[model samples]
Target: MRRFSRFVCIDWSGAVGEHPPGLALAMIGQAGAPELIAPKKRWSRQAVLEWLHGLADAREDILVGLDLSLGFPFIDRGSFFPQWDGSPDSARSLWECIDRLCADDPHLAATSFLRHPEARRHFRHAKGDTGDLFEGSIGRLREVERHQRVSKQANSWSCFNLVGAGQVGKSSLTGMRMMHRLEKRIPVWPFDPIPDSGPVIIEIYTSMAARAAGLPANTSKIRDLATLERALCVFEADTPAQLDRVDDHATDALLTVAWMRQASTVPALWTPQLLTPEIAQTEGWTFGVL
Candidate 1:
């Protein structure tokens, strides 16, 4: 496996207006501690994309992990938007579909897809919004999600569920728009073959990284500096003094990148049995699930 010089984790949000506290970016370089990027200013999705593009342009061998689903559940029908004539069968094609469907959305927003006549049928945007959406199914976990659940005994939410706070559907949809734009410049893992060099992106679950760092499952957010410092200590990472606040977004980003810095060294992370051509083309697996 190729070693990365920098590890970045982004805690993304799908909010429509100004970026929420949930949208945060954190990075750890080879020589320094993990710290939030633009800690003072809220970041719009467009701004975040520009920042990421700049990193790729700088020729840095970086590994970026975004806290969002790369693709929806596709194991059952071999397609995410099954039955729809134009529905894409691959994660990369799905990204293109979403980007094309939501072309008018500013800042890479996915409201267009959510409100799309046919696309909306597959997603649940709000509470009590019912349809034939498979998101409501009890055991619709993707292969990676199932692996994470069985191997780590963690609760993994379906990417199709977008109603509650635990749901990642909205964020994943918005992330798909970003991915479509970035795919040309930066390669996304599982979707694109792993490149021998240059920057690469992957889907990440922040909770998994936190659990790997010894944080309790019940603790939703790490606000205390001491607790956060201890978690960073697990990877021998320097804890930034600025992360004293109680925002889960910032903390999640910080800890995930720290965990990723360590995870990038593990060979199994890049090569898993679940990453077969079928899975890669249909349902992209999460980077750390295996």
Candidate 2:
């Protein structure tokens, strides 16, 4: 396993707006002090991609964890878009498909896929609406999501459900757009082969990181400085004094990076028995979920 020099966690947003409050990023290096990146700035998905590409170009040995699903539930059907004849067979291919379909969308937004007739049928985009698309699906949980639930007891929402605050479908689709671009410059964990050097991105769940920091499962967000500091301290990370004023997004980013820093030291995190070639190519695993 490679030792990463820097750890980054992005609290990504899937809102349709140009600048969503949910978009936030934080980073922590070997020094263990977390710092908020792009503070007070409303970021577009395009800008984030450019920044990540720059990091990869620099050959930075970093482990980047983005809070989004890398791929949808594919194991049961052997494909993400099973009904569609043009459905991609692998996760990377799916990202490429989303990118190609949403090529006209600005800021790497996934509006094209969301608005796609056949594709949109598989997702629930609004609250109070039932996701009838997945009613007859063979499995709702991706292999990794099932592992996360059984092992970690984390309630991971289906990537097909785009409604509600707990829903990650929108963010994940938008994130797939970003991943499609980033794959050209960086290696995405499980989906792509990890290079010997340079930046590598992985899927992350902030709640899992919070759990590793001893936070309760019900703690959806952390706004209190004391609680945030305690979470950072769990990994012996330095708590930023500015943490007191930040909102939940910033705090989540901070805690996630701290958790990533500590998680990098665990051998099992890099190589898990569940990470078979099939799972890697189909349903990507969440980093540190083991």
Candidate 3:
């Protein structure tokens, strides 16, 4: 298998509108600093999905990472949500369920599914709005997530967690919808076999990449070029010029893409020892977790 020639990191958003919060993208090649890919208008979850399709259309041999949970906790509980018959058996089925339920949702938002009377029961929602079956944020981690914590690499929140600033429920749900649509077009790592020579997408947690760049867990965000350049240096990447607008979203995408370029060289990430075929089909592994 040949190494990827290009890399891209997307700071995804699950916000419910045409314009979403914290959505950004950065890309890089074999050598050089990452560059942000932005549209004239603010980014929407839909636009980002479209951009990925564009990459596939161009036949780009790239490794792409999206900052979101690709699959929920399944192996730990025998199903995505224990005791729930509707709970999907595989990651692809889960994506289909979310997409079908949220098909009418605007901006690819998972609003309808999030509000589903039965479906909402698995999530920890807003203040005083936790579901009946909902466990706390730290309770329902996937197998790889548990290993990630054990390795002391990064702390992970359940995809069912929907409250507070760290909540990734919205992003994960909406992203699943995108993944459902992306289906046979682009191969998502683990769930689909990597194509002999094309782009492959994987789940990524930017915090892990930041830690690889020598940043602390609680203070991993880089909101300026100076800090971003320093982080890039950890990967021995070229430093980009200062940009007019700089935020953690832009910085996360920039730094993580560089990190992916460096991290892909490791032999273990592609075949994590703990990642069995069943787990990959159920709860996909994060690229940098190993």
Candidate 4:
């Protein structure tokens, strides 16, 4: 496994506003516990992009885990949207297309992209407003998500469903925009081969990292300082100096960072049995699902 100077986790949001409270960032250096970065301000997608660009500029050796899907399901139906001709064939292309369509959107908001003709046909909107090409009940699961289900880990929400608390549609699309913009500076795992050095981003299900700390699926959230310490102890990580638990995002990112450090050393995690070259190029894999 390649050693990293830091491990970071970003709990992203797809909300319409300039800065979303749901967006959170946390990181741990080579020698200390995980700490939230800029915990005071409501983070805008653009701010997160600037932060990542700074890290890339510094040539930092870090493994960043973003809590959002990198790409929609492509392999299951041979293309992300089989019926539509505009569907991107690969993850990088998908990000590029999303970024292009949402270029005018402020704070990297993807609502504009959702208004696109093809997008409206593939995603389920408000009640009774599902797109014609939207797949089954929960929509199509990416290959990694299917394997996640088989392994009894965190099963991801379909990027096709744009409604409900469980749906990650908006968040994933917005994050895809960030990925597209960051790719030139920072490499995204699977979509871009694991780089020899510098920062690399990977899709992560917070539940998977929480599970690594011995938390069950039903109680994956770590909201209080005590619970946060308990999870960190599982990795023998030091307790964070800051103890603000205003929301679950802080602790979730903290636990994820500690867990990511441990998971990064596992050889099998880097190469899951179910991950294929096609899947890597199309629907990217989550970091700790294996």
- Most TM-score-accurate candidate: 3
Would you give me the overall lDDT of model 4? 0.85
- TM-score to native of every candidate shown: 0.93, 0.93, 0.97, 0.96
Judged by lDDT, which candidate is best? Answer: 3
Q: Which whole-number lDDT from 0 to 100 does residue 147 have in model 3?
A: 88
Off by over 4 Å in 4: none
The residue-level lDDT of candidate 3 at 90 comes to 94
Report the number of backbone clashes for model 4.
Answer: 0
Off by over 4 Å in 1: 135-139, 244-246
Residue pairs that clash (backbone atoms under 3 angstroms), model 2: none
Tell me the alpha-carbon RMSD of every candidate.
1.8, 2.1, 1.2, 1.4
TM-score of 3: 0.97
| Backbone Cα, N, C clashes tallied per candidate | 0, 0, 0, 0
Clashing pairs in 1: none
lDDT of 1: 0.81
Per residue, candidate 3 scores C-alpha lDDT tens digits across 192-219 of: 8878898989899999989999999989
Sequence-dependent TM-score of model 4: 0.96
Candidate 1 local Cα displacement, residue 265, angstroms:
0.4
Tell me how many residue pairs clash in candidate 2. 0
Over 165-277, each residue of candidate 1 has an lDDT whose tens digit, in order, gives 78887788899898888857888887776788889998888998888888788874787778888998998899796754458888899988999999889899888876677
How accurate locally, in lDDT, is each candidate? 0.81, 0.83, 0.86, 0.85
